[model samples]
Target chain A: MTADTVQSGLAAQGYVASPDLAMALHLALSLGRPLLLEGAAGVGKTEVARALAAWKRCDLIRLQCYEGLDAAQAIYEWNYPRQLLAIRAQGDHADEAKLFSETYLLERPLLRAIRQPIAPVLLIDEIDRADEEFEAYLLEILSDFAITIPELGTLRATTRPMVILTANGTRDLSDALRRRCLYAHVDYPDAGTELQILTTRHPTLNHHLAAQVVGFVQSLRKEELEKKPGVAEMLDFAAALAGLGVADLSADPAILQAALATLLKTQSDRAIITTEVAQRLAGKAA
Target chain B: MRGAVTRFAARDPGPAARIAGFMGHLRANGFRLGIAETETALAALATTDCSEPATRRALKSVCCGSAEDWARFDAVFDSFWRNGGRVRTKAVPSNTTPAKATREAEGQATSGAGRTDASDSQKDGEADTGGEGRLIATRVANLRRRDLREVVSADDIRLAETVARRLGAALRDRRSRRVKAAAKGARIDLRRTLRASLSTGGEPFRLKRRRRPDRPVRIAALVDVSGSMQPYARPFLAFLAGLMRADAAADAYLFHTRLVRVTEALRDEDPFRALNRISLLADGFGGGSRIGAALQHFATTHARTHVDGRTVVMILSDGYDSAPGTDIGTALGRLSKRGCRILWLNPLKGWRDYAPVASGMAAALPHLDLFAPAATLDDLAALETELARL
Candidate 1:
């Protein structure tokens, strides 16, 4: 997508368009290299892809990967039950047509992304979670934009899908996969950007109120919380603050705790930042 | 005073907030670097003006490599400004008071000794004591605790921190000695000197010039993995992983009752997963701590296999024994005499009153060249810095 469209679209959504992010996205598109975004979870790596799809007028295809994932699970899986039933029903006269039709494969995310007539922006979310074997399989698809299937032979992409691979750095991705991808590591937004995020997502929030809320959440990140809040949690917190009409620090303790659910995602984090700290923090930040 | 503390805390709220979030747990137990006192220290450092050398030095001293950590302390202190800790917010606190007693300052071992001057360790009485004509010795004495179970909290981060501090102090002593020796004339060896002279002059009389040998220290760590150490195990492994990353001459082994080489396993990116891999490959995750078996196996079998004179074997455990695991002392004595230093790292050593009650502790104490604690994150970091000196 054009830079103007990206800038305006994200602005319309209330998120400030960072020049660094824009440049990285533009460079990835221009070079035809897949973007590898590594960051602490929820630092807007996935959001970048969604935003790109919105600005580019393309469909967004997401492939969620987990442990013990294999090539078949990623590309396509043959309908075993249907094939079994067809073989039994076809009996003596079954022949080639029955066998071929019975073995019809169901397309998975990778094959769908590769075979699409119009390329979509594909997000292989949590790529680090997949095992080494599954990662090796992606190397060819990532580079050549093609995969060899025994049944259907090499399936070539009509157009390369705009790919974004996000990793939480749980494990190191193989050098081969990383070699073909452009990379960036996103960190938590600075105070002003968080305030801007609050304004974008919850326009009803007062300017100072949004800053105070962002400051508190940022403070929470530093405070040895069991599970730290991310950018999404910050936005959720701002929305909560706006919903409660908490324009200033004079809000009741109950109102503050009510907003706690949005920011403190983990029960442990909430418990650690007990009602006392939250109240005191609110008083201090306000 | 209130306004400055508030402002100071506001700017440096990150580490404070983290500690403050669990102040109750720390306060009730009387932990040294409790949330409130850490906040007070954080505030004093933050608002005192970085333009001043003392403030800047304090800032550096308090910081733990992250802006977030600084901010957390600031935020916590800000709340303390509104709340208040055991420390007074007015002016400077007493120099004689133990850092633990000061609200604005957490318990620092060097508090009574005054500010740390990197270049002035000799005058400050923290200099190396051995192998010199004049030795500057300051008693940076051991923590009162002698046993692990009684003093050490099950919490890994806290344990690692305390251990790191003690280990760090000891390391500084070892390093200062080494540096002083390395700085002056280290006498050249003459026996093998003739071998080099025969090649050039066929004359055994002339001394060939040689560089002073700085032998690389080999460090080997063995951690207990019995149920008692379930909490500290992960952080211990993580701290080991960081040491490995620093390319420390270190190898780590885990033992529930049987020792397992976890060197390759901990090489993985994720520390938790690496520990899991060890637990699975070893499966020695739940028996008794075979201190004797572990040490004997290491000394006779392991140390002989990979170590020379400069090796340092570190044992991280509570020293609990179910079996007659005290037999490992003979092997330790053998290893120690062979030029390998045996270090016993007890997490309990950080507490007020700890004793070596276990058979393992009893057996191993006499043989150990150093006894340290690895009970807190700071302890871990200090251990790292100390080793870096070595």
Candidate 2:
């Protein structure tokens, strides 16, 4: 699909991407490269993958990355319990060949994505959290569109799965990893974009209240807060405001305080964004 | 920007020449553009509409190998394409006088023409006008060749940053033990081949071969932020920041009397902002050097977790150990035992008469795989190239 069509499709899925992101996605799809999206936490990096999968009507196979994420967890693992049961039950009749067959193989997200008859969207979320070894492990799969299992040989995808790798930039990625992917850096949206995103996501939210919430969050992001509010937080804040039946998001201390917890995640951030500061931000946003 | 490129194109009337010149300019400015990338970029430009955004998008995808490459590509594209028109706009009066004035003002500030107090600034003024396009290309070339010891002014620092950023992105690859099945390989995948033969009643019809792929070498930067390294630390960290952008697996730590992990701080895209954050975060900044103690601290705390066979530990310091009898040698010995390659970078090595005279230097030298200067942009480029070879 063209950039314009991709943008339209993404918009249909309620995701608003910048021109650069749209272009990057378009190129990635057309060129058959993994799209690497880097951004701060909760800035819709993973959501973009979901939206794409949803738009394309494909299964979204997600691999959530962590500190010690390894190939066994990400790719495939032998069902040891099942194999052991077969061994015990069959006695001398237990076939070693049958025990290590496809029936015994438990496919993880990566392998599942690869083995799908139809191409699926494979989302590797927060890839930077994975250790260097695991990242290195992914290079072969990413570049060659295949996985190797010791027991099962090489499983190369007949239809290439659209791959999305999202990182919060906690750690640097390898050059090999970066080179294999088409890159996009997703940041917090501008005030107008955030406001639009808020209203779009929470269509029932009052326009004035949504603006106030987005503005308040934008102001907070400008501050040196340890954990600034992201779009997800803004949505939560709007939902909270809706719950409170606060239509205008007035600078009233009680109303602001009630919904404030939804936006600020950390105690230090909450401490910094005092009632006084909220009132001022609300007043300014108005 | 598109209008500027269009105007320049109209005057130049040679898109091929202009594009080729831009490619050369990119190469000269340390882009590492391969022949394939150049061909791809050219083909992209040809097939795409000539609109500025489309052109940029096309070239970006085809030409850039990574994010760092994309950034440099954009910067050079802007300068090389727009600056062509900008020179003409300055010399011959344009319809947009205000725009011309604004650009000229920016050019003066960037060019550092008036600040001739420094001899480098004097050289800057000579290349500031008439040959602005040629000037940018030559400036980068000159900056790459100049020694870090000669860099004294802010202008030189800016140039040094540009060079450092380029060097940092040029990361080296290392062989990994991890093997994957390939179409052709040196080793037979017995397990995989056996597994595939199950369909034919244990009669092998298909063969599977495995090949080991090259993995990015993990770079662990231990920068000394002591007073002795004050002059070199900032640029070195900036270089590390560049490496951070290029290689996400790269780790950074700052040490003076203590070792402080600065990997988290260096996540900022802006190196200046990262430096500011580092200053606030690391207590070791501008402190006294305790090389042995810091190495011991790192070895005890972070080494086992971060350093491995694939890791290359690069120490950026002057080798001034505050504690004389401290066993830096033993600490380095421990790190080497972990199978991490050691590279000691001393700024003093940039000096012509410099030697490894310091006690800390003497102790650590035996464990080092590579001992190189970290003082200048040239040294950084050389170091990166040398690492790539290893």
Candidate 3:
């Protein structure tokens, strides 16, 4: 979409994206800068990457991190079997150049993201989860938008990919990685925005029903709950009611309890939510 | 679409169908409202063409309920959807009619902007500014993450006050052990001397140096077993006995409103049992703590007779004086001047706004040579190390 039309498209779908993000994105596009988003979990950290890729029509490349994640998994590693076969086939005839060229070049996400001709959205989720060593390795590539393999030499992004990094604050991220991109933190929506979100998600529900569900969920969060219902949970609860065809809280409390799988993960949370309090609001299920 | 209708009118197919369609749209566009409610809200939304402004406003209101919840949700929505989904509307040229442009620009700033793009108006007189900080606090205070047990649970590890007590007790034990080592001279061997006298026809009398008595160190812990120290009593005593095992002279004592020497009672290996025994031994162990009275009793009855300048006094209490406040301070001051290195550790001071407010704290605060925050296991360790230093 044209710059002028971007706002209208979002408005049509019921979103109120701020102008600062628009300006930051525009500058990022102009200067080829990556965007870094930091925030709490379940606050739509990855959604930004998903939404950007959709809006810009680019491929989304994700590199998921956990303990013990290493450079070979992120950058590139050679195919062992292919390399063995090439070595056997060549025998003494092949030198380092010939044997190495054919089979010893397997690419990982970072290389794949850069090597692709089409610009892709590279999402580094939970960059803070990886250890300091992994963070350091990520920095060289992030800062230069390239990778250096001893065999392959430096492979830079011919067209720099639009990168977005999301962290959940398990640990503080390195300043170097943060400096390479524009930073933003993604918190959840406010009461009014959440209401819009519910209505936007579940159109069949009445205003009173939607408002009540949001109110109840919000109240539940304040209580020392086993698990908090996020925006995702609210939507799931609302959608579950609409599917059951109940329009108010006065009917069908059981379906709300039964649909507990959508919002609550643990059985204990479901037990707490589906009791008398949930029974009161279950009439929203038509 | 024109005016208000009965709640029954919402059941009509045209509006319901439209609502259902919109719910589907919401799902497709990626709002995770539950399966049932998605359909319900859609049914409600389809009944009328609520103005886009009103609908958006209503929708936000419903989804966002708590001040804390909305702040976080708004931040996430702005960051993810805005950065990733559609871009913002283009600004009209700055050269456009100054009056209208300025008015529009001013209108946009006061709305609750999240994270990076808080409007100038919001930073000012708007409700969002003063409230935004609170919102951040509330939302962040309840983060949704995997239940990392250690991070979520309120640990029962030593608090700052308890740590200080344990540290002081440990130091006192160390000092008492040193004093016992010096003061315990050689014991006279009577049997050997008599055997020599028999050889010399009963007139000869000589004595041989014998092994000294292995008297262990005694730690008279004048701990305040008052209701105020209930939470800390268990941990503090455990730490006390654990420190004493390492020191040969350490004897543990506890008090509430009166003095009771529990040196023999808490000789058991298990800390909990030892504490229980001491609690039973002390008369005021379960009563309101009187630090002044306990100190006065120990000084008169036990000071020169049982305890002496060699004795290391360790006081483990929040310093709450049930007696007159001035007396508690005077008594503690006198006790300190008598060669006791007074170290006062308060737990509440570990908190950001903790001030010396309690009468006990006021009484004892001035006498403390070493004041520290001993709120956690680490703080206790720090307290121990400080004792070791002394």
Candidate 4:
């Protein structure tokens, strides 16, 4: 599909994609390559996978990555307890082959995605958190769309799943992992896009309130705070204001300060975003 | 068809030259383009009309393997593809209006017209500047290819420092085998499983696992600063300083007749300040070369703790041992057996058909995985490429 269609399709699923991201997604789909997205935390990196899955009406298989994430967690594992029970029950008559077969196998996200009748959207979130060896191990799966189990031999995908790998730029990924994927960067959105997203995600929020929230969050991102608020924060703040029966962000500084907690998570960040900064930002136009 | 072909040829150069120039610009501006990306880009262009906006998007999506490359690719693509059309359309005669001609000339400059006819531009520049530009260019080329031991000018040393700084980030990291308990791991932690079984009446319900620990690879560089190595010492130290700056975990030692840890002194970002501090701390500077004694010192003090299987130990010297009393071979053998990969960089390796004939070099050669020249920038680039492969 063309980039315009990709953009419109994602919009249908409530994802406001930038032109660059739309083009990247289109190319990734056309070329049948994994789309690797690197950005700061909570910039809708994982949402792209969700939107793509919703757009295609396919299963979204998510594999949350962390340090020391290995093939056992990502692919498959044998049911050790079940095997023990079988050993006890059969008493030397237990079939070793059947115990280690698909009957006793527990499939993880990677293996489940591979065994799907139709291609699913496989989201490997925060891939930079994984170790380099795990990244290297992904080379075989990414390149050939297959995995080798010592007992089961090689399991190739029935249908090649659309893979989306997201990174928060915590560490550098291996060159081998990078080479097998198409790349895109999703940074913080502009005030206009954030406002649009705010209004779209929270229709109960008025334009003035959405603008004030976007302006406050955008200004906060520029501040020397530990954690910056994302689009999700804007949505949360809007929801908080709507729940508090505040029609406009032109409310009192005290009310705005209390509502700001829904956006800023950290204590230091909340301390930094005082009533004065919030009032000043809320008064300004987006 | 013949008329169409002639018109195409008249309006534009072949795609190969244009793509080559674009790729060259990307490389010069620090965009890492792999061979696979280049092949994919070519394949994409073959099946699509490159002038279309969709094709540019497709090309960019395939060509950029990392997010860092996207911004640069966009800038170059916007300037190059658009300017290609503008330049071709504005191919006017010299007798055009002066204002229009000047505007076209400005456009040519922005479009990198000089790079398209680089030789002609160089000739024209030489004629205009009267040999000064050509002289500087020739000197720089010679300095880059010449041995570091023969460098005399301060300008050449400064230029080498800049190149060495760029080469610092090219060192590769090694993975470790030590495992730690993690949320997602390969092997089951039987100990944890047994410990948890007590809570479940000696029957474990959930399985705990362990994963291999990841550590940043350590680099320990031993630079010779004796009288024989005096000429090349500053450049090599600059290279080591750059490496230390790129990797904070890297260790540096300066050895003449003795080994001295200069990691603190060389931590200064300013090359001049770091060099001054190094000169002050190196009391044995320009003294008699003693590779054997220095190796023995490093082995006895720091080898057991710092140098390990994941460590890459680099020894930069001319390999001349003034005092042969201490055994250099034994120290190197111990370091090698400790799992440290030894890489020996000799400044005289490429000069006058040189060989490892020096006593110290011959002894260390058996323990070395890489023995390359450290005499020129090109040699350093080659070393960087080798490290990347490792």
Interface RMSD after interface superposition, each candidate: 22.9, 6.4, 26.3, 6.2
Tell me the deviation in Å of residue B380 in model 2.
19
TM-score between candidate 3 and the true structure: 0.45
* Cα RMSD to the true fold for all candidates: 24.1, 13.9, 26.7, 16.8
Model 2 C-alpha lDDT per residue in residues A108-199, reported as the tens digit of each score: 88888887877888999989889888898899888787888777788888788999999765666776777567677777899888887887
Better of 1 and 4 by TM-score: 4
TM-score of chain A of each: 0.90, 0.96, 0.83, 0.95
**Could you give the DockQ of candidate 2?**
0.13
| Fraction of native contacts (fnat) of each candidate | 0.00, 0.14, 0.00, 0.45
Error of 2 at B376 (Å): 15
**Cα lDDT of model 4 by residue, A121-190, tens digit:** 9999998888877888777788888878898899989998999999876655776677788888787999
Q: What is the lDDT of residue B358 in candidate 2?
A: 84
| lDDT of the structure predicted as candidate 1 | 0.58
Please, what are the lDDT tens digits per residue for candidate 1 over residues B276-382?
Answer: 34433333243345567666656654564455566677788888766674576676776786687677777877767888867667887888766777775566655
Q: How accurate locally is residue B361 in candidate 3, as Cα lDDT from 0 to 100? A: 71
Q: Residue B243 lDDT in model 1?
A: 52
Can you rank all candidates by lDDT, best first?
A: 2, 4, 1, 3
Best by TM-score: 4
Worst 10 residues of 3 chain B by lDDT: B144-153
> Would candidate 2 be rated incorrect, acceptable, medium or high by CAPRI criteria?
incorrect
Worst 10 residues of 4 chain A by lDDT: A168-177
